[model samples]
Target: MTIQTNICPRCGKPTEEGLCPQCRAADTKLLACEPRVTAVYCPVCDSQKRGKTWSDLRMPREDLIAELAVSAVSIHEDAKNLKVAVRSEDTASNRTACTVEVEGTLYSVPVSETCEVEILWQKEACDRCSRISGGYYEGIVQVRATDRKINAYEREVAASIAEQAEESLQQSGDRLSFISELEDSKDGVDITVGSQHLGQEIARMVTGALGGRYTTHPKLVGEKDGKALYRVTYSIRLPFYQKGDVVVSRGGYFEVREIDGRRLRVFDLQTGATRTLAETEVERLLGNVRDAESALVVFTQPNMVGLMDPKTYRTRELSAVPWTFPVEGQPIRVLRDEEQDRLVIVG
Candidate 1:
């Protein structure tokens, strides 16, 4: 009887099928790396660009370098237990040299390879920064007060809200939603935004926090890509009576706690009760609590309290409410009611 034994055709070694593991592993390339790769980034914002899309860099510089280096390397399909390591150094201001080492098993034989890849750094403005530089804006948010100019406090709040909205949108990957300019006009604050979505967000947030409403106006600018482009204006109108205002309503002193449409939520300074009143019921605005003067309590009684006025340095008598207690030595908040020639205890 005659028997046939299998042997590797090229290596002359014993094998189960065609070629031995060592021979096959030696014939295949374990790792292949590109000679050079290009990395695009925004100079102003440090955003990374992958192909045609730009994104904020969320990784450290070293990690980014390692990632870019590994991306330039390709391993053989049959390799198993693959492991890769990268080391990089800055060769120039715009060039990075990287060494990529890979280890794995191919055809049941261990193999390894190391190669060099050069990274060519390129700079390009990101979408948001480009729009800002080119003065491109799709909407304007005008923050104004009803029947008056916006106060300094309102201007500060509006500007802060606009910036916060821009930051939040950009962090959530809305790259085109940016604030191009924040200007303080004679009437109010003007926020120029790169997208109408950002304008709407700022307007909504401002009105929600400060108590008001907004209206939108759209004007046709031109056409792009067979689509009509319109620039929007978000007109935000703050209420006439803002929070913290001391007002006279129905022969009583009340503090404006909130403004809702044509009504005002008031806190009665004399009775220490909270109630709602129509805007037309308010007789006059004394002053905002923010401008209230601090007075020292000279004496306290059941129905009346004596205070040393800050403006005149003279003792004045005012009625106290049950909501707040007056300490004989501590200073208390008081608003001057010029119409009644008396001090109103606010808190």
Candidate 2:
């Protein structure tokens, strides 16, 4: 005798696919979901977020979502913790589950399928107190993104920080080098030198008689005490240029011996020796720029914007919003129709 079987017309299954018998009467639920390959977004700026779902990329939709019971989490594997990795270039959140933003749009980067190392760029997100409006990046907030690997990110960060350190020391060196033309220090503690060329200022100073920027393959940690009580020897990293050019003039030249407010020194090409100069004299000659200053923008006060003049060292205020960002649902007193949709940081 031949056996017969009964199956649901909808699913064409006698059983295992979860058809017929006890499963047809449930409510029909619909949601917005689609399989995406490359997704990028930051949750802090997302209008809405997708609820947690099982990350089974390869599964039949119906069979993939058959919930026996509504539970907190439904992953089949309980012991395997997901691993996430991010690269140095990526400065956004480095999480197994992330709220990442890329170029001001919201999408989730599926880290489960992502790699051991990924190359990403720095975009908008460090300052959190802001919003996204229309297509333009409407808010002025900053955030940091980073990778999962500890060492690579550390190296990148270290390079940047080291650059900043070099630049700062150069600025100080410029001032001291100028003073070396006039007065020398007494304790040698007042003068300072730099380990490498952080920027043009240091290069110009150190290249003294053989003037201009020089690129010396610097050791990672620079040198210490050869002239001043706190003499410095530092490793320098530069561009394609090797052994940065040095210049000589009628009066003298300069080279870095140490970098310390506690102590300082500058080289005199004419004297062909290191000298101790007052930090004050260094300022009068080379230009004493504050460490917080930027090569691009000058500031009258902290948080104020504007490009300050390099010569006079004077600053003017940057533009300000005549009308600030509007409060959602609040009435905006219209002073002028011209200012509508203008730039203001609204909440």
Best by TM-score: 1
Q: What is the TM-score of candidate 1?
A: 0.85
Give the true-structure RMSD of model 1.
Answer: 3.5
- The stretch of ten residues in a row with the least summed lDDT in candidate 2 is 136-145
Poorest 10 consecutive residues of model 1 by lDDT? Answer: 1-10
Clashes of 2: 51
Tell me each candidate's RMSD, in Å, in order. 3.5, 24.9
lDDT of the candidates, in the order given? 0.91, 0.27
Q: What TM-scores do the predictions have?
A: 0.85, 0.17
Model 1 lDDT tens row, 1-347 = 11477788998888877889999899999888899999999999899999899998589998999999999998989999988899999999999999999998998898999999999999999887888898899999999999988899889999999999999998998999988889999999999999999999999999998889999999999999999999999999999989998899878999999999999999999888899999988889999998888999999999889999899999998777899899998999998888788888898
Candidate 1 steric clashes: 0
Q: How accurate is candidate 1 locally (lDDT)?
A: 0.91
Per-candidate total of colliding backbone pairs: 0, 51
